[model samples]
Target: MYSAEIILEQRTRALSEINLNGFGQRHQGKVRDFYSLPGNRRLLVTTDRQSAFDRILGQIPFKGQVLNQLSQFWFEQSSDILPNHMLSVPDPNVMLAREAQMFPVEIVVRGYMTGVTDTSIWTMYQKGSRQMYGYNFKDGMYKNQPLATPIITPTTHAELGGHDKPLSRTEIIESGLVAEEIYTQIEEKALALFARGQELCGKGGLILVDTKYEFGLIDGQVAITDEVHTPDSSRFWIASTYESRLGQGQEPENFDKELLRLWMRSKGFGGDGAPPALDEDIIARLSQRYIGCYERITGREFESDLTQPVAERIKANLEGLAL
Candidate 1:
């Protein structure tokens, strides 16, 4: 894996190199640029640009490397659990992945109910109704506390300028977006994967608080695709201070993008209009956080020369793939 610094510099340079017209920017997600590839595949490129509270912020040096490498690490470790669309790591920020009929929803599995979004769900529950999408929360004697069991809540993946709403299992099945049998398989696979991730994070002195999974059908086979269990796809908290922080009502130390999100929210941006520039100190600190997570989670230090241009390194990786 490339060092965090090298990854970030390369992502920045790659984004700068993109002409943004030739490939027909298929979709511009918060921090990723997707381009259609030949033979039913796509090139997903991570940008150093950060997004918080839904707003895209200034690019952070090496942020893209952290995201991509972390995802690659998990993909390699968890391939036994399910198949993924990963074709090649052509570049530090670029992934050549199999293009599938992407499910229109994001499968979110919550192990703990302590996030801001979870809190929103709880508040809605207290009103004697669970509100997800347009559906009312199921009626039952319920406590607005952490679930003894984690729940799978799926949300639609909306396009820019569109609202993404939640969908129940029945709704997902009835809508014909995905067959019932396939959805069940995805749920089972997702839960098993999340369980394994939690176990691994626990060993690494971190908690896999929650994560989102995406699925796609490839040649009639449903498979887990996209980034899995990365700092971007999941929230991880330091396990050591978790109990103490929970006791004091203080937020636990997290290893995910929440820090950047919190910072962006503090700047009064929430995915609307242009985001403010982040200062050098914040960027440096965030870079350290990414590297720290990689070291702690993998128990391996990231090694790469940051002084070298990322393009050369990426070109080398691609050439190695050709061999």
Candidate 2:
């Protein structure tokens, strides 16, 4: 792992998106650029482009590599629990995966009542909403409070320009988004995965607050799709400070993109109007936070390959692939 100073100095390239037109049919999502390959496969490249509340914020250096590698780590760790769409990671920011019949709902599992997004349980609860996504909460609950048990809150998988709306299990099934049996299977799998994540992250001195998982059908079997346990897909807080912070009515130290969101919120931007230009200092700090989370969650050092440009490195690494 590089030192903080070294990591900042080496964060030279930030990938916002990839334009691999000739490679295959390209589909650019919010953060991932998909290049469809022959034989039901695709090259999924995670970019550094950050988004919050359906708004695209500026890119963060080394963020893509951290998210990709971290998700790869979690996918490997959780492979025994469920099959995933990942075939292999061709590059640090790329995953060669099977093209799946994806579910239309994103499965979100929460162990606590906290978050700043409108779809967040805490946000809804504060707005005088006692019931959310079929889960009813008692009147008295504080922010960042742990729940009696984890709850599954699914949301519609909206397009890039749209917001993801929360949905109940019944709503999902009634709306034909997912069948009841498949939804039950994924819900159990998601909870088990969350337990495994919490166990692993606890050993690493971090709290796996909550996370969203996407699933898809691969060969008629439900498989974990997209990223898992990444800072972009989950919320993490410093374990040691959680108790004291909550006792003091302070938000715990979060390592996810919530920091970026907080910064944007302070500047009076939340998925509206034009986003303020991110300065070099903000980008550097965000990169450091992402690296820190990666190291904490995986218990490994993050080594950057700064010798070549990101695009060149990915292209060279993927030369042997079928894409």
Candidate 3:
């Protein structure tokens, strides 16, 4: 459990450049570092790096723990839906997982027609395009309105921070990115997972607005890889205010990283180019938002060892682990 002042007072930092000497070949990602290991396993280290629109904003202290722990929680909660790559949690910020061959697409399920990114349905619709990601929308749709039904709007899985292109069901099937049977299986799993997420979030007074899931083929079976529902991979809105806010044509109260995105955009960076350095104050607030979501979702306090350096703490916790 940490307060904003506690976060700001912590001297230890875990940046994106951290390296584990004994770990195998490392593939650095935007917010995570993947280390390949023997027996088709991998060490996934979640860093405190904050990202938006496929661009790194800054590092939020302990944000990695929030993301890693949240993913573990969701994966276990939804394990009945499909298998996952998670092997164990060696540290709060690390996941030792099966090195499943991740698919080239990201399974994004949206319950509402909203998002500010270029690939978001709302953005595309606002630009006068009624057709997007294999979903047809009528002209009367308002921003943040719920869709007729939840839909799978998949996107190209851009490794690291590259742009993610939208993919329709037809394009995905016809292009042979994945066999129809396999893709459809994952699709059903994703939808079921989303429904499960909504059911769980409802009890917590949050709406599972939309979330992205990554599935990979492991042991000849489709298993979810990377993560499930987390602040970085999903959108969460306050459920009680959603209806009133929608009726008033106002944005619903949310605790996702879109706050950081809006702050970045206000600074004249619309994710088209490089962004200016983020202030420490905003970074602290962002860390609080992640913590808030974790607490609300799991109904548990987020515990972190602020007295130790994040990278050093990870190294110590992972000392005896077989990667």
Worst ten in a row by lDDT for model 1: 12-21
Least accurate 10 contiguous residues by lDDT in model 2: 1-10
Model 2, span 1-323: residue lDDT tens: 44546545655656777776468567888889888888898789999887776767767778899989998999899999999888899899999889999998899999999987889999999999998999889998999999999999999988766789999988988888888898889988999999999999998899999999989999999999899998888999889999999999898988777878878778898677898777666777788888888998889998878776677788788777665
Using Cα atoms with residue i matched to residue i, what is each candidate's TM-score against the true structure? 0.83, 0.95, 0.95
lDDT tens digits by residue: candidate 1, 1-83: 44445444544443322333345556777877788866888878776666565666566666676677777877887888888
Q: How many backbone clashes does candidate 3 have?
A: 1
Q: lDDT of all predictions, in order shown? A: 0.71, 0.86, 0.86
Off by over 4 Å in 3: 159-161, 272-274
- Residue-pair clashes per prediction, in order, are 4, 0, 1
> Could you tell which candidate, 1 or 3, scores higher by TM-score?
3
Prediction 3 global C-alpha lDDT: 0.86
Put down candidate 3 lDDT per residue, 144-242, tens digits, no spaces: 988888999999987664779999999999999999999989999999999999998888899999999889999999998897789888999999999
